[model samples]
Target chain A: MIHFNDVTKIYNSNVKAIENMNFTVEEGELVIMLGPSGCGKTTLLRMVNQLESITKGDIMLNGKSVWHSNKIEMRRNIGYVIQSNGLFPNMNIEDNAMIVPNLLGWDRKKMRDRFNMLMELVGLNPDEYRKRYPHELSGGQQQRVGVARALAADPPVMLMDEPFGALDPIIRTHLQEEFLQIQKELKKTILFVSHDIDEAVKMADKIALLKGGKMMQYAEPARMLNKPANSFVAEFVGQDRVLKSMSLYTVRDLANALTLKPVIESPDSQNINENLSLRVAISKILNQEADQLIVENDNGTRKGSITLDLIEQFLHREIKESV
Target chain B: MCSGGDLIVNLIEYFVSNFTFILGYTWDHIKLVGLAIIIAIVIGVPLGIYCSVNKYAASTILQIASIMMTIPSLALFGIMIPVLSLINEGIGTLPAIIALVLYSQLPIIRNTYTAINNVDPDIRDAANGIGLTTFQRLIKVELPNAMPLIMAGIRTATVLNIGVGAIATLIGAGGLGGIIYQGILRTNNTMILAGAIAVAVLALIADLFLRLIENLFTPKGVKK
Candidate 1:
């Protein structure tokens, strides 16, 4: 657990980088600090790893203050990643992934195994790209290696400062999805900073909205999007706020609410996973010319059917509830 | 002006007779320039890294190096003689070496400073973001990225030093310059040709040696 208690940062005596900020990131939770430029989101994320020293108050890691701890040891326990994907150019992909592990003096064989596994996890082939340098890979590939490097030492906490901000839209979404899958197993407590509201909505378990270094509101993705704290947050979340909200709730939520038909009719190749969004299910039903689509559980067992009418009612119900 | 056939025969005769004489002078020239360049690097590179971090010092140091560069090689040698006299190590290879070291400083210092500072800020951010210590960043990341340009600077300094070294004989230091000086005083054409040729050959060898070192040490990722 990470906690910030009345933190403030004053630069050159007068300029304030952060002001009286306080928050907590619980264990195994991915909390996104979201705002525009100069919002001190990066500063807040950095304070967890002690990259930015707290000018006032205290930042507690596992209930202990960071200021008194050995800075290097504190940082080593927290994996750090940045937008540029700071893989060392001199080291090959393999060595880059293992740099932190090596620094921590993990046994050589264990590090080697972790390197290969991380490479595969990040969609890179260990055998083909292990010996290659950062420049040898494309921007997306380099970012993958950067992510792999951050995850190498298996730290319990990760501090990411716009880690995917540099990638193109498609690659960013792909990485975000892959990262979600990775997080399921890793279950690391992550503090991510992002200027993009879409990225925060997609990746955050809890969103802390900030403006002028102040926490405007902290809520789950759906609540933050649908019921914003104020005008500033509403405007910041932008248009299609309802769509963003609808996307956050799963088809399973909608399907479970509806009466289930145990029978499967007109077997179709396109089957929807129960965990998918209502938006995707609606589109799939229309594209396949089916009034209702099959919904499968985690084990690929047909759990129920989701019809387009139910999707429409769900949207209407949300609109009514918001009003 | 001899015919082509006569020129070749003369070249062969010159080589056959003066091989040992030429070889000894060439070795002296290499040692003189090599030591000077190495000492320059030992001093200049640290100065460069220091300057890159401290802006006030960077401008001051670069200004001093530029001023040093403006001094004529012979004039610098003349200044060094008295300075060395204070230490009682005057008037020969020592003075010549002192002159070359001063001459080499501009390239080595300027290049090291520029190379280190020229490393991408984003890369440096990543290095620090990932928690490598300051020294670790310099040795592992900053140095590797700066090396291609730094090596280029070293190559420039080495070649320029070797060429300037042909004048080392002016201070009574034995080198190809001695043969050239003797030939000039005695009006011996064979000695002049041998001296000029041997210096030219030594320069090519030195240039080749440095270039190979540069290629070997430079990180392949940063190479063009």
Candidate 2:
């Protein structure tokens, strides 16, 4: 739904922050602009909402040129979340979350209902938090409120600039999982910016890796990990690309790809959900020193057993097939 | 000089006899200070908001306010006499109000500018990103956040003006200063003490009143 057409950003008429960037973010797709700092990822994302001015080219949102669109109206329709959570310190939780809706002139009852629903969507208890200020909230709670606020108006597209970057690692992971679940239900077109590779891989439908204001590689996480566009892409994806790509598949995926070993029930063995990722399986095997793990469905039906040897074979088969 | 106890009783007697006189001057003092402060707020607050927006004007405006602050209140009153005389308002309440308002600007403008300018940049970014127009951002976001510091500025201005209002009697503006000046002319320490004490009491009361107002106006979310 969002398309960048030969976009360029040059600061002070000489410092090129973004150089002729061209990409399309498909509808309902979460496209992550991933890169190290100063790769122009943030500048690029801000260009979508016209927060940053375009030096040379234009960006179109749903075929309407963003530069030519009414800036205020266009932004009101697009949700924007930043790393700081940016909850207004002077407002209570409900007021902060319902900012856009209130601006759009939703009546008090409608705003109240929307605020409660959004808080629930972001895993906050609206009634308990409605009167509380941003300062009264924990970092994670504040960030949750930030997400709810962005989604308050139920905008068609969302621009999140490292929304979870400020939280501690544990909280960050929890929020990421919760956000992915939220995205599944809402399916809003999202342009997420992140410097962390694992975050991009875990949450992005497509990864647009950038370097020094240039697009390095733009592909699915699995494809980018397996077949990098260039040397920089491979290195940027990291030396452990195989292991990183392993996170993309679940125990169920492996079972479907090949025959699993018959279950050898043992008192010391741990049963893991079949839907869990291969990365988790690897960690369990190495940490518990179990030769194999019994995989089960949600109802505790034994699917089969998966061993380290079996996992290796599955990876090879998948790589070979993709190649 | 009488004994300390005798001095105390004598002063109480003087207060009891001239209670109505003291009350009238106190009312005049309140009116003079109150009118000047209200006028200063009306002019200084908008000018401060303007300075925060226009970077080029901020330096010039702030410098001018600082200079106004540096001028002695007595000198400011003296300058007001000649300048306001051309407008047919040379003496009395007009020149006194003019002097007090000029003295009030530095704190009000400085504090307002700093308060608005220093509103967390992140919040400002979020405000703009969420599609608030400039005017709405100021009213709903920046100004509400700025209320505490802006109120602090007004409190400072109010207290400062109350002390300086005592000087208005020098220019024939009737306030508690008139009582103090008359006492000085007659060499009566009791009258001087009463007027001086009244000005001090008025400053304390004004500050406390503003603190209450500051509490009322500050957003609950931002209260420490």
Candidate 3:
């Protein structure tokens, strides 16, 4: 677990970038540090990795203060991904992924194996991409390689700074989905910083919203949406908190045994994946005449189904709990 | 037809008779230009990198280089002559060598500094973000990225050095300049033409050689 105790960052004679910040990120949880452009969320994220030095207070990793370890070794063990996708132009994708490992003096065979595995993990084909340089790859592909490169060493903690901010909307959503799948499998402790609240809600296990460098609210997406800490948060989350909450949840979250079962009677022409957003399920249910929709998991196994009545009841229950 | 034919005959005869005489000076010219350029590079590249790294130092070093560049080549040689004379290095290759070295600093240093400083900040951020030490980043990333521009500088320096080396023969530093000066003193057009053509070819050869290196070393990803 990563713990920040009264962390504050001061610049040039006392401009407080972050003030008296306190937060704990549990191991294997993806925490999105969300705020406006100058909210110092990025500063807070960088401090965990010691990229930005803490002006005051201690940041402990696994209950040990980071100062006790060598800075280079500490950074090597913590993966970092940036929006610019810092692949070395001189090296091909394979070499780029192997940089940290190469520095740590991993054997040739081991680095090669990890490169192939990471390429597949981030949804890039190693055969086609390994020899291509960073400049040769498209923006989306380069970012995918960036993610793979960051995870090449299999670090327990990963820091991502607006990893998808440079991509187009379609590519961004696709990458986000792919990343969530990776996160689910890897379960690395990730501190992701983004100004986009929708991204935070979609991907974060917990969203830490900040205003003027102070924590406005730090809670699960559902709680943050339903019970905003203050007016600033309520407005930042917007009038469509309920609708936004729907995006945070998916078909699998609500389609329990009450509505989910093996496909029965007839197979509808359309099927929704169990992993698809609830918004899509709602659209599917409303668009078609069927009362229910088929749901499949990652393996394409016909796990369960979602019905119109179940979604309505789930929404009603959520509204009741929030009130 | 008569005038043109006579000119052709005169050139061919001049070349055949003076082939050995020209060959020795050509070798001397190559040595003069080659030595000066190599020494300049040895001093220049590191100085340039240092200037790029330090802000205050860059302005001072660049001002010195710009000042050197603005001086007339002949006058610069005159200044070097007296300075070298104090050590009994007066008149000949040493003073000329010193002059050539001074003349070369502007292109080599300026190119190296600009190339190194021009490396994208994003690359440096990423390198640091991924845990590369500052030294490793310089050696592995910055230098390779700056190679093309640095090579361009060296090539310019080599060509300029060769042209300047030709004038050094006036100070008794023997080269093709020996031929050019003799032709000037005796009004021998044929000798002057020969020296001029050889110097041009030498410059072209030097430029072509560095271009090959620049192309070979430049990262494919960075190429347009």
Candidate 4:
């Protein structure tokens, strides 16, 4: 667990890079720092690892002040992944992944086993990539290696600064889903930085929205979208927030909250799984020009039919109850 | 005035008759160039790394090295002679090696500085982020990434030193340059050609040898 107790950052004795910030990242949770560029989100994330110094207050890791911990040892225990992957060009995939383990004096065989396990976790074949240099891999592949390297020591805390910012949209989305899957099993307390609202909405268990070094809101993605702390967050999350909020609710969620319409056999109706988000359901309804989409369960049983009107009622109820 | 064909014949005759004499001078030339390059690397590489970390030192040391290169080699050697005379080692191998070492400094140091400085900033971030101590990062990441360029600097110094080392003969340090000097004194074009060819050949061989070493030391991940 990481706690920020009235943290602030001042640059050159005058410029305030971050204001009095207080937050907590609970164990096994992912908190995303979402803000515009120069909002000090990066600064806040870096301060946890001592990459950036604090001017005031204290940051505590597991009830211990980070300032009092040995910088190298402290950093080794916190996994860090950055944009551009940061894979050492001088090391092959396995060696790069094994950096922290090797430094911690893990035995060679254990490091090898850890490397293979991490590679598999990140969806790479350990043996096939063990000998390959970073340059030999594609950008997406290299990012996977970067993630594998960060998890090598299995640190309980990981900090990611736009880790998927460099990839194209398709690859970026793919990696995000894969990372979410990884997070489910590992449950590392993560503080991730991103400027994209959709990514924050999709992945963040909670979003810490910032503006000009001030926290605009720190709440769950659903709350932030449903009831923005202020106009700044509303604008930042964008005017299409209702549409954006649709992604947070699955067709199953709409069905559970409000009875979806009974299926009326229409040739134009599209078939969508109940596991898919209401965002997909809405899009299918509009794109296919059908009155509804037949939502099916994993076992291929008809759960219900989801229409655009049903999603609207569901969103309204969700907002009212959360308030 | 000898014809080109006659000069070739004379050169072959000189080679056949004075093979051992040529071999001894070649050995002397190799020794001088080799020693100077090794010493320059020892001094320059560390200095370059130091400069990369400290801004003031980088400017001061890089300026001094560049200025050192601008000095005429003969004049530099002449200056070294007087400077070393205080220790009573005015001429011969001492002054020659000192001058050669000074002449070789700029390329070695400058390349080292650039190489270390240019190691992608992102990689440095990753190294630090991953908890590599300063020393560990240098040894494991920075130095390995900096190897090819540092070796290039050494190669530049080596080749440059070989050509300049021939001038050591003027300071009473015997080398292939002595043969050329003798040829000049006797107006023997064939002897001059023999010495020039031997020096050029030595430079080529040394460069090739250093290239092999560079390849061996370069991390395979960065080969391309």
Best by TM-score: 4
Q: Which stretches of candidate 4 lie over 4 Å from their true place?
A: none
Q: How do these models rank on DockQ, best leading? A: 4, 2, 3, 1
Q: Where in model 3 is the C-alpha error above 4 Å?
A: A257-276, A285-310, A319-323, B1-5
Decreasing TM-score order of the candidates: 4, 2, 3, 1
Cα lDDT, model 2, residue B195? 85
Where is model 2 more than 4 Å wrong at Cα? A265-269
What lDDT is obtained when candidate 3 is compared to the true structure? 0.86
Q: What is the C-alpha lDDT of each candidate?
A: 0.85, 0.93, 0.86, 0.92
The sequence of per-residue lDDT tens digits that candidate 3 reaches over residues A170-224 is: 9999999999999999999999999888998899999999988899999999889
DockQ of each: 0.63, 0.89, 0.66, 0.90
Error of 3 at B109 (Å): 1.5
Report the TM-score of candidate 2, chain A only. Answer: 0.97
State which docking tier applies to candidate 3.
medium
Model 3, TM vs. native: 0.92
Lowest-sum lDDT 10-residue window in model 4 chain A: A283-292
TM-score on alpha carbons, each prediction = 0.91, 0.97, 0.92, 0.98
Best by DockQ: 4
